[model samples]
Target chain A: MKKQYWTEYESKVADDHYYYERSCIRQSFFTGSEEVFINIVRDLLGKDIADDMNLHTCSGIGYYSGVVPLDTTMTVVARLFALMTEAGYKNFVPSCITSFGLVNEVVDMWHHFPEKLEQIRGYLKEANGKEFDVPENIAHPCDIIYKYRKELKEKMKYSLTNVHTGKPLKVVEHIGCHYAKIFPRQVKGGAEFPQVLVGMIQEWGGEVVDYPERRHCCGFGFSQYMVLANRGYSAANSKKKLESMQPFKPDFILANCPGCTMFMDRWQYTIAETEGITYGENGMGIPVLTYEELAAILLGYNPWDVGLQTHQVQVEPLLDKMGIKYDPKDKYVGKSGAFLGEPEKPTHLKVKAYE
Target chain B: MAELLDMISADIRYIDGLKACMNCGVCTAICPAAEFYNYDPRDVCNTLMSKDEVAIAELLKTDKIWHCGQCLSCKTRCPRGNVPGLLISLLREVSIRMGYFTESEEGRRQYAIKKTLGEHIVDSGYCVHVMHVKPHLHPEQGPVWEWYFKNSEEVADRQGGNYNKEGSGALRKISEESLKDLRKIFEVTGGKDFFEQIDRQSKKKASELKKNITDNVDDNEYFYHVYREKNETQE
Candidate 1:
């Protein structure tokens, strides 16, 4: 079974000269993730990642939530490809896992139904007065990071080992379900155990914690989170994963997808607030970080500069564990050195160094 | 009534997602939504396979189809390569098109998404823009998020975000030309029509329920009804 799925799951990642597509959720919520990703890929690793200011959202959220039709999604994606084509790049790299999956789904549709692709082309020409060729390569940023894991490790100022215990941090790798489950072949490792994140963690000197519900969705179900009443379903699914990973006592939850990273971090606060349950030691919720933010910390970037302060579950605990130093006073300090007020302290979730 | 199976069959997602279901229940076993809710991906697939239009129509109107999180986890585990999640997507599209979605509590919430995410796409070229993330609406974002949004510009600037600026970077203002092109794409691809249908149907439902809905979809009265109203019994 493994061999069959593995054989079916081959994909080629472009080494350089890529068109970087931004993620709506990551930009809106985790504002620093995309910056950290671009810095790591472009500045640190010395890769050419060309971005277009004209690129728009893939509408994956709206499409999956059933408000935007699939045809609309296809046309929107076609416009994105058109922009990439205009920029003279064929390697498409979306910052969001949802966009990656949706783009792959649209391209797969085009492959199976040429008429639909033609319709999209007509729509593109009529609407935007442009044309597009499907990208030659579609790789997620994590895939690129995985491709350069060894080089990144070579340049790392810190490792995933605990400063206190002198042990490898037990990291829970949460693969966004859409990242691989939608099309196993598109992912680095097959759907069951996606190695994109695990590979990064292992190479960066962290032990991967194998939990039972590791394969479960972080429950960002586009509709589930969008609708206020349906949020219970979203919170419940995250609670399930946290509960499963609680026994292992992971140092942090590492996710590649923006939605997964956000939900896994925020839902910990929700669970702590409602149920008074904390997943980490000393009544603290387990911190969640995107692979980029994790990589940024290892590459010696300041914690707050990577937008770690925006995270619901405070990343200070994880930073402390990994021996990454950050000024506690700088958590709310802005670029001009002004103190931008702090959040109202949570009643249940522990913050400020386990006290 | 439109043939439910035909509507589903027309979608490429359905053609690819549904191959055959021997009722193995692997999809159900691995389904997180099933574990949490009354949803069963196996049953959803079986219903479609049965080709019973009435049963299928009934499934469309119920809250079951709306329960899927769109994670596509079922696609990986099915021995016959069935993708129950994609089946849910097609079912949802059919339900909305046929006006069956408004019949259920969960389905009515699509109105909120239509007003927010759907409209955000046509208007701002983003489904969830930073400016639209009201702290009051998203309390789960927690207090820190409240702080960030309170000082969003400064915080964004510190993090190297353009923050609604004219140039490329995180949260840069999507260009008007790009937005015009996006709106055109939506207009040409039936997205505009889809949003209008959602508004029309939701307003009708609001009137049927005597909620005094106004012309503006973003008004608090009707918006809150669809966005926040919770039905414990059905859901």
Candidate 2:
């Protein structure tokens, strides 16, 4: 028997409802991106989306990091599916690229080995006393957005072209490893050259820049970075990517995975702070944005309102290029629009406005 | 020795990751861990194929398996279709199961990951929650994150997350019934067993090393010892 993989896009946008599964890292690092996703789906796309509190983390990090075993990881995924079934959701949208990959991988695994599926079913029965119907439609928000790029582009208040220069912004797209690498055919483009992110960037009027290390991992390496001692391995890889992309002079980076986004964003700061070396022009790092964040920006959401203020690398340079209007005073303000008092700006940030 | 080799051969990850090694250095050339650490995936595959039980056992007891970032970059480039990343996963599993994980400095730190992420999942329903990722614990989250941690609830609220409140939004309180079901799933799926085994093995290691062992995951001296131990060579 030949090894079979998904060759076509297998997911569709939920016409009416979607059970939005949260990614642990995304909610933790880019809190506003999830909200922006919800806004785009619910308020903009006119879909009734529910980010259920019942949905647990996919434990992708734990499992991939080798702390959690595969069987346990599958069961946890099975339990989440059961929760989705209980919630009466037939369409699934994952917030994290890693979670998206895990869910797809588990579903495909169960498909290939019915015995394992039955084993997980038996476990689910023992645990919840319920049977789960696998979601009919499952997609990462990126996929959903990719599918509706035309509609999104139509709804956009801003394009990816620089407002000042009137030229398309040079954007680099970093696809998470789990997004397509695990199951290449499942993604829009095969793993070798994925276009899921490129589709979004192009549709939003940005020039997608391909660099030498375009396929490099963001170095989250879960355990490699999580354990402080092993962080050098993670940092080294990120440094490699920074060095690879430095020549491109990308105005910004758009990542589909929260881990990738966080790492690509955070590790630049880490590399510069620890190693005293920086990438990109003028020793200022390229700003990294989650796909949802870029979407929020294109849809005219305030930069500060979308939590760009929380980024270690100042997003002001990109915002200025895009001519996005945001108040510096409002950046540190509370939910009720009250100023929370400013944090002493770190010296690493080269942007005078942010400093 | 035959039994140990059988265990390796039987593991699906091992089966999936290895086809036939031609001693190709592609896996190492592309390996991020190899670039920094004294680790090589080609050597790992070569040793596993050697089927020497002592060498395999020694490999498990060393920090070598831990060095794999599990990026699966090896899977992408392997001309023989071998996945050294997956091979690492299987080795790590067997090491933990056999208590060989406690034999190395890096391997002993598995307990810290087990306690932090393992307990975080079972208790909080999420592997990482905003509340649990304290600024003090994760200084890499930086000063803004420190502020966010202090004003997390408000920040969550502003971002349209439900935080700890009840409703259909991010970080909302997972229902007790659902949490119960989650716990049951863990129980039935052997997740609890896996965690307990890690704890038991680590405790035994701690006893041998003359470190204090406590039932409480947080208060356990061994847990804190590994968790806070910084690499002298980190810089």
Candidate 3:
């Protein structure tokens, strides 16, 4: 039998299971409001969670789009740490859609072909001395989050309604590329825009604004080539999505990933300037947020605690537009809502350091 | 002045994509070219807004922008959805419009490659996945994957890939036609002859580089030259 099938059986038998994997964007989540959300999940649900950064790169979508080498990606994922998630009896869960998708690809590939898997195993053993046994039910944070938004909402202390004086947020979602591409059926609780971000936003009192390019991947693929000064294939793709999304005039453009937020927010000003166009009122740019960043606001966490200001593009204009006035200058108060406080360095550091 | 604004607006209209930007900064943080260089997608946005063409020209001069490994990571990870990889191509338009496409050996090489890609797609209705190789006469890097995939056209025909040819081929053709239709959009050779030149001579020029490396250097050295050395030249 394939390794994934057995893992599926094991996953069904066990109730409380979770795993963490590699990411460059994980830095955003570990910092502020996202950290709070993770803790809430653990305390409120009593599920197991593992976070690690020393893991191999997820091959990223760069490979899929025909840029990075295939074998290098395999070596990075298969040889380095896809196997690490198999331990301690918890299902591996990646917060990044790319990482999660890579997990599924690797597990499915190595399970069926013993010889090819051995070659991959040998690559791992030779390159990093790591052998992966494939985890039981490797999945995404969205997979679980989408399934459990109702439970999450019930346990919340604050309300997303009345977030602004009365205006519901004109929020649109930035679904990660891998999650939408690889696990579309799972997150597609039947909507043009997936239900997870919409459900969380609308229930939390933000109005879901469906744009034409709602299911688009922000120009992160060409992000690495950004030195090309807006003259690369990726930039062209970025413009494609931007033009498609231009009609909606979303107050807040929310994303599930750090990379997405940075690309949409940080690059807009350049797109505005070089192109000599006005992006927002008074030439203001669109405000991009992570799901958890919005979660913190809706949950009544302070703005800074959610790292709203840390964003390259300002969120204040959109806040004002939505009739929500978060003092962007609010300093972190070290409040521990459910999971963690502003640690001396952050306790999660110890986990990766220990590994 | 209207013409100037039109040209200027058109040049930076790629920024309309920035308006499309969700401001996720995935392009900034994940950008390899941005990481190593003194570049930031955010800074690029700010600079673009400043509209100081002097600063813009200075920024464009850096080959750092060209160091893009052509990895579509930025496009894939983009959340509010934009394609920075395509932006890099637009940036390349700056050089093309400057009339430097055939200047340096490297520049000529790039022109040839693009010309080949443009030609082959028009001819076969699929992307060029392989390069033509001729042993002893052609250079080592000369053939590319073309020898293996040379038969893919037939395989495409056999496997129903040719059916979608209308979708992609016509799309590229329409794009090329619309670009040409833009009375002002210049430098991209829109004529069919341009692509044919690329297709005819790609193997010849490829052999020139292939022999330059294969006869003189080891495989590892050649690999390093391609994957590393080229990127290190920050010009």
Candidate 4:
């Protein structure tokens, strides 16, 4: 009966023909994870994923933070759909889960209130002289990865297993709240236990730790972090998740949302600095990777090129455990082999530096 | 006060989120904010269910509206389908428009958001541009970020980001034509007016607090106060 009930919430993902919507914050936070994802799709899988430079943000951050009004958010969303319409694509894929939820929420609102849709249509026409057809399909990047996890596993150079112990690496997968909690039917699995990241982790030869606070948010509440005064709430919430997962002894953390990935990574250092506690083994912090980064590592992309170094919690410890070989010297080098200078190390989180 | 209630009643979030509440604590029990902060989604619903204008006005004027993380987790658990998170969104907007956002520490911090995320949307077509994640403002971003900040162009190019360049890819420069349309959308939809309201109310509040306010939005003394000032009350 439980299995039967969960199956009712499964979402349908499009096979191909994706109009890729780049996330504004993902680029700022995760740096090159989007590029890695595009490469995995276009280069590895031979999928046709299109991107338009004219495309802008969905204004989700501002909208959720309470500065941008709903009317403006709706108009901005309409313009994105217009870009998709102009590009001759029906499938929409947003890199950020927040954008995914924002678009879905706006479209759902439009469906329930056609008057709001009509008002937005007028605003779009008057403002930009453009119109948009609602997209036929909307999928997050993780949904795409989950759909083709088998094909990716076939092309893998490494697995999530720890090469030293020969055991499946234990991982804690944090799904962004907006990814499915708001609308369960839109995700691969239901809201309670999303299979979007779990499907990928299992396919890549990893063990998923079922933590008590698994459903709790990573607390990248837009205004919570944007305003320094409220950041304690963000940190405290993340700490709760980390503390809950601590007893599970997970090897690393992975998240689909860029904001969650960032907070989970950085807040480890913040926790270490302020509270003098670390979640991972030894004195090192737990490595936090995006779904794209995890895929890139297994697919044999250069660690630096995939932007693993951008994370505050060092990925080196995890890389070493996985026995993925790379010249530590190349970590800070430019694309042309020119060496970029190393950054100062922190007092708490352990980061490997080579002269 | 009645006008404020009318404003909230007209919002789509309010219309969709608040159906009917039976004073159940299901939402509060599951809420992450409730665990950390002195927030209860049940109390918020109970207040709205009463429909008392004075109480609603007081709710809007306090930090209670801003206590929500906007995770919408409350929506998933509500037996009556009352989404307290969405109601909070409505309450927050009404708070800002009514100039009641300046009444508390949390509400006043919307000024920081206005200068950063709010302004970034109009100026860069991004809520968070790559160039704006300065290491100084975001110390949590850590040491590697400092290196990334200095060698931004080289690193961005290597990572396949367009990094303010024309054409397609990650962090590509959004075209001027597209930005003009985006700006016009903000204008047509009253987002520009909303930004002005945040600015106007925030400036008035700054004067009330006697902080050194200036025309420079980013570097002003009042901006610094709201952006960095630690309110220990949260802990």
Candidate 5:
């Protein structure tokens, strides 16, 4: 019996030994996303990778937010859910940086917060009737894919191959704060400005342009922006990011997570309006694209087909610059609650945890 | 003055100060707190200014207020110097009063960062600014601390300023002392003792965790090793 419908990403995880963790918050926000990444990784890396996967909610993220507490053992047990994905496997990947850091944080601090860790261990023991060994190795999705960048580049069937135009295409990198700050060490390919995404982009033939405030948070801290005028602050951060990259003349600003993509892309126009910052057609007012979107484009997929035009700012110039033909109808309709079909699942999807 | 003070005294001292911000968003761009967390400093300013109690109240329910790293990076850079970071401090104060984020685990963790580093500054007449080599160069952050706690004068000299000169650099001590007072407002306001206990636990727990991490840290420590080795090789 063939599986009814899993994202192409599942194929890669199944074949590639994809790493991941399950996040409670993400599971709550969009349950389909983790499932999408999971199924995709399983399909790609072969079932063995999923067998070794453990996606779970990070232990302490919500506690600091004062939302979830130390006693909120559900988040920790959620790790067991991911472990069950691979039957209590070795290190799995976490897509969400926060989940990655917080899970590791709980494990690392368990020796110190013995009671907190033990409480979590106890819950997992009773509830799942299973034990977890916080594996010695773990990594964020970016850190993992970054390790195989050369292989990804070699296996490329797409023509983002021309994005650099035989000359290095200018691009700026935004490393999520949780990725850098949570567990600065688990990040292999080295830490301290690990350049996981940027290195991958460079390997794919794009220049990883360094902008000031490169490692600044994407302003998603607990979705404060959604709750208030964090829009202004997010917009402001976007300006700082865009302004910093102005000198470098990057063709596009690339974001990693969905939150950063939303703020950087949506808030740029608003930030520009409020701050009185000017933008030329192909200038400082650039659009933000995620690596998934970037990868889709790098593979020479149709811009609208992959939702490029869904961007708030006009992404035409970059396409025009790249000489990539774009579908006119691909433009995102007004944000008046119009369904643009489901957001395209990124091909070569990386499995993750809130892990 | 009555109206302004009325706004200020209305349980949240930042109400008046926050109103001064036009929501220009300049503060958010420069805030180091926003750099690490998903918070927008300007949003706190905007929320305080909105006078829309429900929105403000709903927002206060989150722990984002505690995410403020309080580097004063936003304060220095605000076009009006409005200090959204400080405004968030006021929010935390109000949240404490309202019992929103009182004694949060993160706050407890922060309390430790402050008690260990902060208490020492209050007692020692110095801040971490003077002690420790540039954080990037110091791996353990202890040796440089041990040395610079005594020899900070050389760093002061290098910066072309004598902090001990009562008329010039010493003036900073006044603000530092006052800062201790301002923070006391945060400490003693509502759940001060609760904050203290969490701070204690966090400091104890954090140090223990750091020891374990450091003990297990592989041959490659942090960027400190890379920088030092690279500098030596370059030289």
Candidate 6:
């Protein structure tokens, strides 16, 4: 039976031009995912987008993690808006989910207190000698894709069905906390049950598996994970999600936020190593893919070409299930199409002979 | 004294996070951090409600305020419309401003983040740059990352990123003029003062702890002490 879904807000479409602001964690942890997003938007969808070098980090991590103050964080975000305004772009599309939330929150804050907005404008003019008009539309890349899921599906070279099994792949979606929790009304499908990811899964021909703890955090709690002692909190929370989802036997986990994606992917390995236990079938952890990576695969892009090799959890099992052809030998190859020396076999995976 | 109340009232987050606390413990029930540690957002709100200066000061100096993940889950679940997450933000701000951050082990580690992410934004215009993420520092990135780091320029170019290039694309170099404006924004927005406050408090704590204080956060003994210190506790 198809689970019921409803979205409180309508998704925004970028149409053509987007002022792309990159995420800090996404660039460092999953550089390839960002690459895949730009390629799909430019090469596949043929949309005009500008990734401005002048835009600064949203400073969300520094503020939320308790190091940078709120005022500074807001000011930094205002400066980014100024950069976008200067570039003559109004459609704000942030690469990071946290930045998307921060922008929304700052805009809301400014609305409630126009004085604060005036204060930020004063500071920006004094500092950079410029002013900015607030963006007419601010959307996450996932939201943009969600708005155009039907178009993407029409252009898709592959579906989410397993090529050999002739059945839909069972997929689970994890939404980041900041994506909807702060302002539930702004998100598609509200916070209790978000359909932003589900819309993509459905359009791509995948069965969305319902599981307990679906709304729980991926536990990238900046300080919670950064502090070694507090990592148990992260592990414990992830363990809850893993155990709850293990019963459904999901083929893969899909995430929108880069931080959540990295944490869910990497922490599965950590939990397996530390606890001497593992989730998923045959004790091999379920692969976690960012929404963009999933989009790239569904579009028939090579898994290794999209940089799946860098994942802590191997994605070969999923590729094998989908009957996707990729050269394992090229997984670690450099951009120059040269071998980067063989990577030492990952400790978690059992040895297998090459065909 | 009324000064504590005055401090809380000065910030809008405090005003928003604290309402009449009904003490329902719903925030605690929904808190992810509370499950792992002895953290309770309800308790934080309760204590702040006491309006006691000594208690407020003590709360600022302890590791409690740092425990919140700032996921704002409490904001979502709180029936009374109170947001403990925002209260925690206000507490953290006050703590750093007053040098109370050095009083706790978790609080002291603010230096590490300040040096890495806080400084990275001003220096590079990006919080987490490709070259700055050392493999040794983030071993979870695994062996593939080491290779990528060595061949980053080539890989980035092939992947459509204009990394370190002087043009518009992913990870492109920010012009010197823009960088100057960024630094000026910090100065005008009080971000520079906030960073200086963290440095001054860290230096003072280093002297008190008899650790060598240096001009650079990377070289300072106090910085290393906080960054390298490990908590032996495990769940």
Worst 10 residues of 3 chain A by lDDT: A345-354
lDDT of 4 by residue, B49-81 (tens): 788999988988887788788898898888897
Q: Which stretches of candidate 1 lie over 4 Å from their true place?
A: A1-11, B2-5, B215-218
**For model 5, how does the per-residue alpha-carbon lDDT over A158-235 read when each residue is reduced to its tens digit?**
533334456766777776655544334345322235566767777877777776667665555442331222234445
Error of 1 at A144 (Å): 0.6
Please list the residue runs of candidate 3 whose C-alpha ends up more than 4 Å from where it truly belongs after superposition: A1-15, A28-34, A53-56, A59-68, A79-86, A111-114, A155-165, A189-193, A222-232, A318-355, B1-235
Docking category of candidate 5: incorrect
Q: After superposition, how far is residue A63 of candidate 3 from its true place, in Å?
A: 4.1
Q: Could you give the CAPRI-style class of model 2?
A: medium
How would you encode candidate 6's per-residue C-alpha lDDT over B2-83 as one tens digit per residue? 7667878878787667878899999899888897677888889888888888899999998888878888888878888898
True contacts kept of each: 0.89, 0.61, 0.01, 0.83, 0.00, 0.54
Model 2 residue B130 lDDT score: 82
Clashes, model 6? 1
Give residue B100's lDDT in candidate 3 (0 to 100): 32
Off by over 4 Å in 6: A1-7, A12-16, A349-355, B1-3, B215-220, B230-235
Candidate 3 achieves a global lDDT of 0.46
Q: lDDT at B107 for candidate 2?
A: 86
Reference-based lDDT, residue A255, model 3: 76
User: Order the candidates by DockQ, highest first — what do you get?
Assistant: 1, 4, 2, 6, 3, 5
> For residues B1-235, what per-residue lDDT tens digits would candidate 3 score against the true structure?
2332233346332543344565568877766556444555655554445667766555455543444544334654567555564455444444334333333332333432332223333332222222222222112111211221333233222211221222221011223332222211111223243333433443344455573323221342322233222333433
When summed lDDT is taken over every stretch of 10 residues in candidate 6 chain B, the lowest stretch is B226-235
Candidate 6 lDDT, tens digit per residue, A254-339?
Answer: 99998888777767777766565666556566888998888888788877777677677778888888878888777766677877
How does each model score on TM-score? 0.97, 0.92, 0.52, 0.97, 0.52, 0.94
Task: Give the number of the best model, judged by DockQ.
Answer: 1
* Cα misplacement distance, residue A273 of candidate 5 (Å): 4.2
Model 4 deviation from the true structure expressed as Cα RMSD, one decimal place? 1.7
DockQ of each: 0.83, 0.62, 0.02, 0.80, 0.02, 0.58
A188-278, model 4: which lDDT tens digit per residue?
6678978989999998999999989998999887888897667888998899999999999999999999999989888888888887888
Model 5, range B1-235, lDDT digits (tens) per residue? 2332243345222532344777778777766555645678888777667667776666656656766643344543555636564466456545534444423333323332333233332333222233312423322222213333343343223222233433222112224432343233223322235345444444344454352212121332321121122122210
Worst 10 residues of 2 chain A by lDDT: A3-12
- Indicate the worst ten consecutive residues by lDDT in candidate 1 chain A: A1-10
